[model samples]
Target chain A: MSILINKDTRVICQGITGKVGMFHTKGCLEYGTQMVGGVTPGKGGTTVEGLPVFDTVAEAVEQTGCDATMIFVPPAFTADAILEAVDAGLKTVIAITEGVPALDMVYVYEVVKRTGVNLVGPNCPGVITPEECKIGIMPGYIHKKGPVGVMSRSGTLTYEAVWQLSNLGLGQSTCVGLGGDPIVGTSFIDLFKMYQADDDTEAILMMGEIGGTAEEEAAAFVKQHVTKPVAAFIAGRTAPPGKRMGHAGAIISGGKGTATEKVAALEDAGIEVANGPADMGAALQRAMKRGR
Target chain B: MKVHEYQAKQILRDAGVAVPEGIVAKTPADAAAAFDKLGGSIAVVKAQIHAGGRGKGTLKEHPDQRGVQLVRSREEAEQVAARLIGNTLVTIQTGPEGKVVNQVLVEAGCNIARELYLGIVLDRSAAKPVVMASSEGGVEIEKVAEETPELIFKEHFTPDRGLDDFQVRKLCSKLNLAGASVSSAMRFMKGLCRVYSELDCSMAEINPLVVTADGELMALDAKISFDDNAIFRHPQLKELRDRTEEDPYELRAGDAGLSYVKLEGNIGCLVNGAGLAMSTMDLIKLHGGEPANFLDVGGGANVQQVTEAFRILLDDKNVKAVLVNIFGGIMRCTTIANALLEAYKSVGFNVPLVVRLEGTEVEQGRKIIADSDVDIITAEGLTDAAKKVVAAATGATA
Candidate 1:
């Protein structure tokens, strides 16, 4: 009933020989995800973490029949790795690498769209369906399998919300970190549709920061199609204009992408907005009451 | 990541796009020599800064001194350059603090029969590179879009294939370009697109794409900014970065693999993740405190980065308190706690400090901080941390 990934989903790690790749791959394995094999060009026929390593994604997919991939390739080669995965017919490709060039993403976006492949992030904290599967770098212990589906454009912020929900005795159906880049593979609206369709997800929690019209667009989509209870927290309200607050996408630019505008949009859509990060769980509880 | 006007023009000229001949002068003498070398009836001395709207901007030191001024004599060029190169130019884009103009671009003036706006940006909405054209030139494109939407024509092109010839022709026709000007516009638009894609530019704009009396289209003003992520591929473009135009703390943070933006406030923030860092700032403000700066130590930050972050925060004289919030994911809480203790010993914090650690290895991290005799305030949650830091910063009991 979890969206995107579950216990049955077999995963392969791209660039599994790299330091970060090996570390997270073992983490995922320890969390009980089916880490079938990995792809590291020039390191084929070798094994790490008791899993086989292939030269390319196609070889890994063919040998292990892996349905999904977690990419840890360097930013310079991340786009090509995603392309390789898509070309190998992977249904879900999650890129955890950050600093990927926007132009590379542009080309990758076009190809992914043409091929109808679901790409998750290039700078995100990956995805996790608590208890069933862990496919990202998110802490596994803070999660519990339950009714809420969580998604955010941040890494640690997502962990914050998930931890708060867990503390409230609320578990999650799945949590997706959509990355904090100006150009990410997945959007709020895209994940909204999936969370809405998942039977286990009775409510949705979305976290957004300033910069870009994705939040506004997601608000519009939620108002029309989403029937489940929904709550959101938009960060960077205190941010000054024209200053990039850490994230490339988190900025108040051109008199647009302000937190006030995003909050207004979400509230107008009838979604409960959390006053702050600590208030996210209570906000979702309020949303559930309203939905009932 | 933004380049000076003269540098942008040089890039444009190298890419086969027509631009006004310009020389970058670091001193008034160089400017005067540049003006003499151009040997034109009129020349322009434009102050070199990162921001746009320089033409309408004025010097802070001398109110009557404009950033961009037309000079008929070399002596006038020298005077204008002298005023601009050593003073701050306040513009609509630059804040009231403005930016110091260390150089000036002296270019030969041209005869403009008409002016139009042309720009290429990585349009997030369309998820493609878009070329926007408008007949209303020398005006803010945002104003033109807001006031008269139909006046703007756009063509979205993929980075792989670039803008098609037909798209360029359509844009030229939309701008009412005819005869020789049409071909010139084609070369200008296509070359600009090439520059955007090949150079991995985030934004490439020409404020006034001028049509001369002889029906030649030229980029009168150029603004080019490369994507910071892609700069690793272009070492040459990386060299174009003006260190003087940036905040020293921000530059230092960049070198240390941390993301930091200096703000005007009292509470210094060091956090993990950009979103969490911003949220920490928002929470601080909500609790009646202002944040001094936004610093994201980033995922997988090591001991050195944490110490560096502490040093940067302590370096800000406005900071009265420091808050460290970490929600470990790829970064473990224990690693951050260890880093914090390490930083406490190495950097030696004077300001009242509050730490909130959560996520992986939380218990161990808390125990590590609790066992330390480093004089730290520990909070269980983000809200508690914000309230405590604000109270401490304002010298109130929490």
Candidate 2:
């Protein structure tokens, strides 16, 4: 009942033999993600943790029926890799690669919209459906099957919130890293809608940061459509305007995208917001009390 | 990444945008020559920098025709140029450490009937490059936004899909534009788009695209910022970065491939996790002292990276102290400590350095640093390290 990936989701590792790809693929396999195959030209016929490898995405899709593709390719080749995945008709693409060119993301948007495949990130940690499926680099120990739906722009903070949630024994339904690039595959609104429809997800925990209109757009959607109680935490409370804060997509530009603005937007939409970084779990717990 | 006004105008003229005749000057002598080049009585001496505060300051007018009035004379021009040459001149249009000026624009002042701003920049929300037009363009676009929000007109363009005839017509109609000016602006954007696509630009702007009484859409300023990663494609722009005007720490950090942005704070941050880096800064403040800079030598920093990071961090005079918060993760703490000790020996800093190493190899890393005899204060927890830094910097009990 998660938003993106689940038990039945067949996945492909785009740069399977690469360091990041190999590391996360093993973790995903251990977490019970349905790792069907991998794509790395010239590394075809090799097996990583017993998963089949193909030279091309087209071949991998044809042979193994991999539905989701997690890309860990280098920045320069990421665009081509994404185009290839899109061409092969992958319904879900999660990019663990960072620093993909903004212009390249424009192409990703085009390919996703034209092909109707859900593209997750160019610089995100990735999506995790707790114990059902673990994609990307999130520490598998911190997440488990629960009713709370989570989405974040920061990869590490997602881990932080997940650790906190798991500590409370609340677990999670789906935690999607929408990515922290100036432009990304999906917006918060798109993910929120999916979470809203899932009955298994009783509440949503949106982890946002300063920058872009994604959170505001999500708040608007929550106000109009989402029936589930939502709690949120916007990072960069101490960050100055226009600073990168590590994530490429995260910056307070033109004084528009600040923690204050985001928290207010969420609060105005009737969602609960933590005062700062430490109160994320407490905020969600408070929101749940009110929702009933 | 913003190019100077004069430099940007030259690029615009090359892109076929009609621009006013201008020359960059370094001295009042240079200004006189440029003034003569105009074949007119006056010239505009602009303090060319990546920032936008020059207009409000003494940067917008020509030097006095006679004896050097530091505000208007050749000697004054020399003095102004001297002070501004390598320093970042803060401006309104631009923010912070301005675009460093290696050259100055000594131009023939425009005979303006009206001033308008026409800018094309990345629109974060729409995830598209937008062309922003303001009829009230002479003043800062921000002022126009705060006072008269209705004056700003934004027209977005998808880079692959070029602007069409209708958009051009609408832009002209909204601008109340007329004559050859319309065609020229259209040609400029078309060529500009060519440059934007070909050069891989993040933003291309023309502030105060002056509509002369003579009827021309003359480009008064050209400000272009290429995507930093895309700079490799446009090898020529690599020469445009001026480190002289930058925070010494930022320059050194950049050279070392670490993301370090200086702030007016007392606590120094060295965190393994990017998210942890920020959270550490907030927590540092929560414990009562500001963070001096946002420095994250991303996960798994080796000896050279950590040393370079220390060198950069110490360069910040604003950083009264440092708080090394490492949630070891996959990054080896031993490597960071070795680097820290190496940087300390090389830089010979007397400032207090507090290290909080957690996760894998913490004991081994701490033992290495301890063996180095570098006199670094080691903390067992995040809160303990933050308190140590705050006390060291502000002389207050944390």
Q: lDDT tens string, model 2, B66-115?
A: 11122434444455555555444444544633445566676666678778
Candidate 1 wrong stretches, greater than 4 Å:
B396-398
lDDT values of the candidates? 0.92, 0.76
Q: Write down the DockQ of candidate 1.
A: 0.84
Q: Candidate 1 iRMS, in Å?
A: 1.0
Tell me, what's the RMSD of every candidate? 1.4, 3.9
Question: What are the candidates' individual DockQ scores?
Answer: 0.84, 0.45
TM-score per candidate: 0.98, 0.89
Best by lDDT: 1
What lDDT is reached at residue B310 by model 2? Answer: 76
Q: Candidate 1 — which pairs collide?
A: none
In the range A123-147, model 1's lDDT, one tens digit per residue, is 9999999998899899999999899
Top candidate, metric DockQ: 1
